[model samples]
Target: MIQEMAETLDDSGSAAPRLKQTKQNRQSQILAELNRSPSLRIADLAARLDVSTETIRRDLDELTEQGLLNRTYGGAVRPLSTEPSISERHHLLVAERERIGRAALPIIKGGRIIMIGSGSTTTHVARRIAVELRDITVITHSFGVATVLAMNPTIKVLMLPGEYHATEGANVGVHAVSFLAGFHADFAILGASGLTVDGPNEALIECGAVYSAMTMRAAETVIVADHSKFDRTFPSRYAGWQQVHHLVTDKAPSDALRAGLDANGVGLHLA
Candidate 1:
């Protein structure tokens, strides 16, 4: 019987793991996923990491207790402040931003001039835009938007002069608004911190004036936002919904929101 047992153990290959999954390794992975998205579901994390649900639950519990993440019903999210920094927002709602960026591409086809708004979603648009024309020109206040679009050798980048907000990685203030006064564009692509029924709004007072100027200078306005922006209001209102010709987003708005968009003649493009 001992000889048979020894032979069976040897035939089973290796009985011990070459590398073990430690608590530190699991916690690092959990934090990484949270950084990539605003929220991460426990079940999805378990499936991706090849761990049991109970194991993931325990990991989340420990992480939350350490103040690294905040738990929702079944998921975890980054602990955000009243105003999250640009670095903090860069990876948030990645899929939603990609879809919204693709949806807005048609609006830029055959355009001579385009104005880009400053924000992470608009930054995604700058990255995703397929440059078909060599003579196309882009105007903006965002350092990030300018840097991304500059990757295209054929496109001309016009950066507005203003006071730089280190956190936003963009320029804003009276100087930016004044510089925008001298130019005109065929279309203005704007991003908002919040999109209420009344209009598009900005959380940062610095961006409010310059964004308002951008909207006024362009002939057409398209607001690119994820569903997370809806029903939220900020103090500074940049432009009314009637001024917004198009709204591109990943999720459908509520019936009340639909009526508001209809009343203002804003075309909602579901990505």
Candidate 2:
């Protein structure tokens, strides 16, 4: 293909000089955007670049694979750092996470007994549920989620007893997992460090077991993450693509992920 393209050009000729220039310009603009803002939201980038969010995700993936950028749960950042922990993630993409939370609201209709895992995004869901719904029994390992839902007197919040991890603001230990094994929850609403076609992933090994236990007890499982988590991966994978029944995100996933979800019969909900 390279030889054919070169033969089609004169000493300094090409079929699509303008096209090459355009691609180069787009990539350059992306670099500029990242340099200016260490962490750039994929949706915001798409809007600024006048393209779809999926396009931005694709571009970011290519760049990250080439060591040009880093991927986050809801955006991209410089390659120097890993995805921010849940403690630091609340401020990164608050609006987008809130939107995802809202999108996940209606999914709780049939279930008053739900288990919410720990994360900034899941905290948003707990917030929405605290106000939007009533008279529910909520179980969780996340202190943050428990605190938020506690405000609603009508809702019964059960805290799983275990060792508290301050950074994740959640409990993760054998006790918690054992406690969760006692009930078949109506739904398991969870957040992840990253997500891929393979499954939902977690950053810390400690939480992976707890999350896996939660999913096992729940009648249904839903993963709530943003588009930035699409191609991102983490060390601990708790649930497989087949285990997730629903996915809520701020933007559409890439073609491959969507196809995988479809093949696995995973419902996709974009906020």
Candidate 1 Cα errors over 4 Å, as ranges: 1-81, 130-133
Which candidate has the highest TM-score of all?
2
Each model's number of backbone clashes?
A: 0, 0
lDDT values, one for every candidate: 0.81, 0.83
**Lowest summed-lDDT stretch of 10 residues in model 2?**
1-10
Q: Candidates' TM-scores?
A: 0.73, 0.76
State the lDDT of candidate 2 residue by residue for 1-271, as single tens digits: 0111222444666554222224456667898887665578788887887778887788888887899888775577766435555666776678889999999999987898999999889999999999988988999999889998988999999899999888888899999999987878899999987777888898777788888998999989999987667776778899998999999998888887888899999999989
Clash list (residue pairs), candidate 2: none
The sequence of per-residue lDDT tens digits that candidate 1 reaches over residues 126-242 is 887634446788999899998888778888899988889998888988889899989998989999877778888887888878888888999999999877676666778999988
